[model samples]
Target: MGNICPETYPDPFNFNPDRFIKDGKINPEVTNPEAVFGFGRRICPGEYIAVDTLYVLISSVLAVFDVSVPKDANGNPDIKPSFSIGLICHPDPPKCSITPRSDRHKELVQNLLNSDPTNE
Candidate 1:
C-alpha cells in the first residue's frame, strides 16, 4: 500500500526516476522507495548491499549496451511491460534488443567474456 501511494509519489503507475531528483540532485525530502525491502523491525538487512549491487550491475550493462524494446516489422517499438502475479512479482521475459552501443563496447564485452576463468 505504501509503495504505490499517490500522495508520496505523483503518477505512481508511471516509471519516473526523476521524482526523486530536484535541482540536478537527489531530493533529500523525497521519501525513499524502501517498502519492497519490508518495513519496521522486519526490514531487510541486505537492502543496502542489494541496492548497491544493482546500481553497479545496471551501470556496467548500460556502459556496454544500448538496451531498447525490439522493433516490429513496421519499425514500431514493441514495449508492453507485463508481470506474473505471485508472492514475488516476476516480470515476463522482455522482448528487447540489447546490443553493444559501439564497436569499442562490443570488443570490451567480447574481451571480458573470453577472459572468463569459468569458460575454460
Candidate 2:
C-alpha cells in the first residue's frame, strides 16, 4: 500500500480525483486508488459492496448538501485538514460546514430523519 501511494500518487494526502481523468476520460495509465483493497489472492471479499456503499453515501451527501470549510469571523476559511497516523489513518477531526443546498434538500433530510425506524 505504501509503494502505490505517496509515490504513484502525487501529493497523496490531498483528495485529487483528477489524476484518474485526462482528456475527459479515465486515464488508464494512472494506478487505481482502489488497490488499497489488496490484490491477487489477498483481495478483499467485500470490495464490491464496500465500493458501492461508498458511492451511494458520497452521492447522497453531495445531492442534498453543500459541504465546505467553516469560515472564521473575518470570513476567511479556517481549514487545516490534518491526518492522524495510527492502526488506521484518519483525519484528525477536521472542521467542515455541511448545510442543506436548498429548501427541498432540507425537507428531504428532515423527512428521512422523521421516518427513521430507529428513532421511534
Task: Give all candidates' CA lDDT scores.
Answer: 0.85, 0.84
Query: Total clashes, candidate 1?
Result: 0
lDDT of 2 at 96: 84
Candidate 2 wrong stretches, greater than 4 Å: 1-7, 71-80
Steric clash pairs (candidate 1):
none
| lDDT comparing candidate 1 with the true structure | 0.85
Candidate 2 residue lDDT tens string, 7-28: 7888876656688899999999
- lDDT of candidate 2? 0.84
Worst ten in a row by lDDT for model 2: 1-10
Query: Residue 106: error of model 1 in Å?
Result: 1.0
**Per-residue lDDT of model 1, residues 1-120, tens digit only:** 765688888877564678999999999888887788988998999999999999999999999999997777999775666789987777788777789999999999989989999987
Cα-based TM-score, every candidate? 0.76, 0.77
Query: Alpha carbon lDDT of residue 116, candidate 2?
Result: 98
